[model samples]
Target: MRFKLRPSDDAFYEFFSKAAANLVRGTELLNELALPGADVQSISERLVEVEHDSDAITHELYNKINTSFITPFDREDIYRLGSQLDDIMDHLEGVGSLLYLYGLTKLPSLPREVHEMVNVLDQQAKLTADAMPRLKSMKDLREYWVECNRLENEGDRVYRMLLVRLFSGEYDALTVLKMKEVADELEAACDAFEHVANTVETIAVKES
Candidate 1:
């Protein structure tokens, strides 16, 4: 399989980059929402806008894939990439939704691992955005996916620590349930980022 540095139609790469930017925005909003005394409603609204923008970009990508005679990568790969990117936004939005629904006045003070996990996720989103446009060349991109995988591992460790603390007679059972739901959503967002990375790696291998 031979890959070209420039595709006949560059719109796909452009859309991918746009979608990645949306993901980064979503991650940043999530980090903000995770902070103490953060305005949850405002941050959630921002995430909602990001998700809507991403959806439009994803739709444009598929439309281009359908109409274009040539593409930078396999059509299926393009579809998978768009879908996984959308999933990341969805999971991030889910985090915000949980925060609002739980009606908690503040983020939990105990078992403070969520902040670190969101930090890793934010880094992963940035790395992914940096790598998406370079897909045309498939050049020096393996490091991004590798780092995302590493971050996902780190997130898992933090998640498990939080879970253990949550169950170890910390808050009441109801509070634990609410906190666990938020934690789980954050962890799922990390996994969604890994899925995006994995899809990018697969596309690179096939194109290589």
Candidate 2:
């Protein structure tokens, strides 16, 4: 076991856990978009609400970092982790908003690979939510970042396949453009999750 002289600031850990849980909610909303005859506008609105909640949590965390003399880890790391988590939510909201705005929901169905991308994000979100609470101990975190990287690679593959499907004369030119934008946001969310994991790995290494 490793030991360090750090304050017993559970609030920082709580903030992280809350933000991660919010991510789980965001991904769940995104998954609803994959269902048949799903209501895109409602999901988009709920996602926006969840994104706002994440923003509030991040704001509170930043304020905590400013007021607290001692933090669980580097203050910068805490902020980066919070920002990265928020970035994921932003991308999620973008996915929903793009679907509604571009009227992509009117299609009979979305490509299978797009849902695969959502599945990857859903896994990442749950993994992150599970890992954030463990930051208080900084134990068993190696699996989190490792698996997150693997999932990101998987998401990349799905994204590439989605683009191929999008551009293979399957969709109209304008529709392809709209879906590509949404795909970009989904891929970005996958990368953002990896960024959070990488930051957590960094904090664990520094404290170890």
Models 1 onward score TM values of: 0.92, 0.98
Taking every candidate in turn, the Cα RMSD to the unseen true structure, in Å, is 2.1, 1.0
Tens-place lDDT digits, model 2, residues 37-109 = 8887888899999999999999999999999988888988998999999899899999989988888888889
Alpha-carbon lDDT, every model: 0.85, 0.93
Minimal lDDT window, size 10, model 2? 1-10
Q: What residue pairs are clashing in model 1?
A: none
lDDT of 2 at 184: 97
Runs in model 1 deviating more than 4 A are 1-6, 105-110
Candidate No. with top lDDT: 2
Estimate the lDDT of model 2: 0.93
Q: Give the Å shift of residue 132 in candidate 2.
A: 0.2
List candidate 2 segments past 4 Å from native. 1-3
